[model samples]
Target: MGVPTLVCAPHRLLRRIEAGYLDNPYHNAVHAADVLQTLHVIVHGARLHVHYLDPLGLLAAYLAANHHCAAAFELLTRHTELDVLEPLSTADKAALRKLVIELVLATDMKQHFSTLTHFNTVHQLASTKSFAAAGSSGEGLLKSAPGGRLANVQQEFKEALYADGGPDGAAFASGGPDAAAAAPAPLDDSERLLSLQVALKVADLGHLAEQMEVHKRWLAALEAEFFLQGDLERQMGLPISPLFDREKQGVSKSQVGFFEFVALPLANALSSAFPGAQPLMECLTSNYRHWRRAEREAAAAAAQQQASAAAATAAIN
Candidate 1:
């Protein structure tokens, strides 16, 4: 509704939608549902009497959903939608699309610290304002939050996350920046803009806190695709991760890397971000840890059973 100065760009948008579906490992219909549900939780948390959330709950969530276009590329693990953003017109339609795209693009793992820092600052500012206007016991964030404290923490967090400097050195930023890089932009704007950006941020990370079965499926899909991509890299003699040691058969040690270096930390960090999210985060944490513990248990049990079978075979032999 906010895309003024333009009527519609169905052709371009449709192309984007199609590419989003094609490229994302988890950006399909299921991913859409997960993101929407994540928004619902955030919205409800803000609705709580203790944390009224400055009445920014629902709209913020929806804004995230609409901005899902940018992450569609990385999550999909493929170059499924880069071309379409070009056809989008200038004026307001392009402007709104660009806004949504920039925030969505910023959700990359490489930007997590920086984005969180920004979020913490703005969040603190919003929180402090809420406190002065209405006391803390009633809603949203910590009541004890101090004014301007948000900005400082945010900066610190950003430096901590991105301290190595530039995302180019990271595995996650391999795709590079998206179309939103054009003309650059600022964070200030209308409620429509803020709501959308906030929503996109949470939605971008929403899947980390979903049902185990759901998260498992995403893991499986991405891993399978990751291996395949790694294989292609080997065939072309490109610089794929060493784990891919693809010259040999079977999946590489990369899955362990995924489990240890990626999923585990992601689950831990997400839980700390939202107190209301503890339960779901635990479930996800358990699931992420399953491979480590469960595999051992299963192997031990299998070994005992195999011993019994060997005894029987030897007795007959």
Candidate 2:
């Protein structure tokens, strides 16, 4: 648990990171801060600190949240004053840099499904191992859990799902399809970087797990950014990306699709691995429901308007 001391005060480095981000509506400094805070919560709540990640890995995870892209890493490298890894051994420094880069890269939407798949594999394997070792018993399976309280909760979670033939229970019991794929590179006691990578990805999309009003605010900012991109594309005589054409895309439908395909699955995978983080899935579910309802209402209104137009045309004839 020997995290290195920073060359300068932590706030000094944080200020530089904050200043490096541009004024993009959804990708600015505030978004970085939100990801950092969310990552911190996920690590602690999931007990990653207790059982999986060492101090260096924990530091890397947090750093990846701020330096979430190659550009942000370049910003860090450009300034000697912000060398948080200045005090580490050469090997430790290399390891930390590699980890931070990989974690940041995983935040790319292109890698979204692949990253989620890997985490699911890890969780399934771990669940199978835990259950096997505990054989015909569920007690003390969560030794690394903070206290008896959470251990009990973990046990209850196990019993409710695995004992009741739940869908998740079947997946864990059978190790799913990724179990063989995960065997070659199983997790060790020292570092669970894969899990941390999943945590970073989830934190990047963390706004989806916020309260309804907060979630709407983030969606508004994101859509505004998308619309700006579409505007630039149109000006340059280029093709606009899907859902970025604000004039054609209905916000309700776009959000419903995004939540279903991207947000909810990722959040559910994380929560499945760490029951303590289940509240995240709950928030996401609520937000999803809101979007679905909005989608329905929008469709109904459109249909009504079309019908009214037809009636008026017939009257004119």
Candidate 3:
């Protein structure tokens, strides 16, 4: 909330970040800004400032929102343009850089399951601590009940990060498989940082929280990106990713499954943690229904086309 002033050098940095972003339909500077705005809405709607986050935490969230894709771009091109952060004190700049990198790297799709697992574990610990505190007072419950459990959960998260080969398991942070291995452990409040990582992730997919038209546009852009990748893979003689092979993948059906398997669960988890964020879950539900209808229509049209072709062949025969 108050951290915007602290950063104070965003325009130059944003321009640099924009310059480095891929020229894709999505995952560009515009998309980054969109996600940043969505993160603001989520933070406000969830009353994160009032409940879960301090000023520093909010700052980290905002930084993560803005720079979520910067690491990828940097890694890909070996860009050092993030020097716009130089306006801050040396220590502050370094901290912000590390935090932004960690948060951004956590957005890698490959890390999705492990990130969610860590978030869920932290969430459970928070719930247990809250319940224990409710029953007693003055840290007594924290000390007697969930203290050991909290330590264990934190350790597990740390171990998961190491297993992924980074302080933040930011496997893609430096474009190297093991670049993050030498990075120092995260310095912020571990629980708060983990939650913010998850929040930034949800915000990155915040198109699912938009209205149907907006959501469809984003989906189309993403599909275009996927198809582009598939085209490249074909040209390079590499196996194409599922749903990226535009010739065979039905966008509607794939989207339906994506929502059912990925988007909905993420929305449900966020809404559970921050009740005020239920609007996101509602929007996700609406989007899922729209996709399901599209999927059914697509299936029917394909079936009809097949039937008509078969009939014509029989008549000719």
| Top lDDT prediction, candidate number | 2
Please say which candidate is ahead in TM-score: 2 or 3. 2
What CA root-mean-square deviation does each model show from the true structure?
13.5, 9.6, 12.9
- What clash count does candidate 1 reach? 15
TM-score per model over all chains: 0.46, 0.76, 0.68
Assess the local accuracy of residue 308 in candidate 2 as a C-alpha lDDT between 0 and 100: 100
Computed on alpha carbons, the lDDT of every model, listed in order, comes to: 0.43, 0.65, 0.60
What's the C-alpha lDDT at position 191 in model 2? 27
User: Model 3 over residues 254-280: C-alpha lDDT tens digits?
Assistant: 777677556666655555566555556
Q: What would the per-residue lDDT of candidate 2 be over residues 1-317, giving only the tens digit for each residue?
A: 47666676767777877877789988888988888888876766665666656666756654665655566556667887777767878788778778778778888899887777666555545567554544443233233222213334455544532332223111221222322221122367322677777778888888877766676788789888888899999999999888778888734357777776777667666665666566565556666666677777889999999999999999999
Runs in model 3 lying further than 4 Å from the true structure? 1-9, 51-90, 129-188, 297-317
Q: Give candidate 1 regions above 4 Å deviation.
A: 1-16, 23-33, 44-95, 120-202, 242-279, 286-292, 295-317
Give the better candidate number (2 or 3) by lDDT: 2
Ranking under lDDT, best-scoring first? 2, 3, 1
Model 3, residue 291: what's the lDDT? 64
